[model samples]
Target: MPVDSTGHAIVAEGLRKRYGGTEALAGFDLAVPKGTVCGLLGPNGAGKTTAVRVLTTLLRPDAGRAEVAGFDVVRQAARARYHVGLVGQHAALDEVLSGRQNLVMFGRLYHLGLARARRRADELLERFGLADTGAKPVKQYSGGMRRRLDLAAGLILAPSVLFLDEPTTGLDPRGRNEVWEAVGSLVAAGTTVLLTTQYLEEADRLAAKICVVDSGRVIAEGTPGELKGAIGGDRVDVVLRAADEIPAAMAIIGRVTGGEPESDPDTRRVGAPVRERVAALTEVVRALDEAGIVAEDITLRRPSLDEVFLRLTGHRTDERAGERAAEEVAA
Candidate 1:
């Protein structure tokens, strides 16, 4: 029997989970539209993994309800499992086997016959840009190749809802880009993806919608631009020629922007949010010149998703993202 379809690929309401006294999910709720990518973001220990586990049927929620592909996670665990797929932080691949073999094995596990498995493996290999290396040993493949194979295995059954928990965790810039491109291809084919990642840029680029979780619940949710707008708009930054000019610059910036300006002692730079980028920048420059303060640098910049995360979640996006990485992204 086919499950009834709905506009939402996944939905949850008032989900709660407790590990001893730790409340992992306190009334967590979300609704992801079908055929779109949704990014789940939060700081470390934010219950992101727990939420994925519950939705994938790996961990049952202590209370509330979740539906994936129109099947209840708890009551319809068996049915839900069939319509969902999971790709964890690490690439789940057999180093000794060739890429094709690994994918074929996944197909077989999903009950496809040997002939069908081979056909499916070939199909995925080509689709994921692994056709050239499909016959090579997994250990001989690049980090990106192996990650693509892991993603291919997950799609063997073409499950409607795919759970990606930090899918690009430790990949090099090149490798991460490859995986992202592959994910983009899948979503274009109408796959509904639930991505949990530490990269706000990733959410900004890939997620049609983003849900920021904190203390086991959603703190804010919106598109990347919308989230950034919630905190304010563009920012004007000025680097003083001398560190001693910080106080003077701060006052000028504060008065022009109607907001407190932030200072960086080391860079001798001052910055503040502004609604009008051009007007703010112009006013700051005019004021500094009249005051005989020389600014080594002055510019207006748009707010980054990083700023949004910090203002809403009470922590820097890099709080858990390790050292800041170079801008890594893909189609």
Candidate 2:
């Protein structure tokens, strides 16, 4: 597809990369619309980091093409570099430098004049909510403060595209929210963002579109709600009064819902998929009543992103060892 001239911030096609014996990326493709946020999510070792590296020009792709901010990632790498900002998983701040000094240092690296660099540093200190701590050494800053400062450093050039790789890995709930708020503000002001995160909740809340990667390939892509809808309809959960009655409950639920019923051996709970939640609930309760099965609890809810991931990959995000082995082979 041709790149859009108006606001196509990033376009990548068939991007491939290898690290010695391992293949970090295998024909990966991505297109990020300008002025929007796209969340890249997958289990550990899913080639997310490798893809980001290639797009940001940190690592070269063996084959394929990519453009960032209208500049080719390979032939015009320097131009691409100037239009992008990266906030990596680790804080890239110098512990000995004060927050204000760190920002100023990055501004100078971006080739800003000394006077302009100092003015930008002051502006960022306030924007990132670090105005009061600007003079403090980074070593004395809290984890959240350091993270904010690191992000401020990336924004020194005011690049059109920003890449955030697990920006809130170890932060508290409040700290995470602060970062999320900043990201939201940036998007609102027309900055394109490509964010990779393991947190499903983070993707669900912030991503305009989500791309699920596994084994260095794009397995699925869609809006959060669209992916959930594709997994089927609402879930009807029935809790039995007696543990021994699980088998009996499952049989009745299957017949009533006309769908496969899954049972938990320990809790005597059964769940089935249903097209209509209210109708399914009513039918399940009446059927159980007729079968002489007592239901202790009943609830209906939509499928979560966790379930969606499992249904698509047959494994959850927390299944690390298997993913690592797959990644090693792909890499």
Against the true structure, whose TM-score is highest? Answer: 1
What are the models' TM-scores?
0.87, 0.83
Per candidate, the number of residue pairs that clash is 0, 3
Model 2 weakest 10-residue run by lDDT = 322-331
Q: Return the clash pairs for model 2, or none.
A: 22-331, 23-330, 23-331
Residue 163 of model 2 has an lDDT of 96
Model 1, 161-215: lDDT tens digits are 9999888877887888898898888899899999998677677778999898878
- Candidate 2: regions farther than 4 A off: 1-7, 233-242, 251-260, 266-306, 314-318, 321-331
lDDT top scorer: 1
**What's the residue-level lDDT of 159 in candidate 2?**
87
Candidate 1 yields a Cα-based lDDT of 0.85
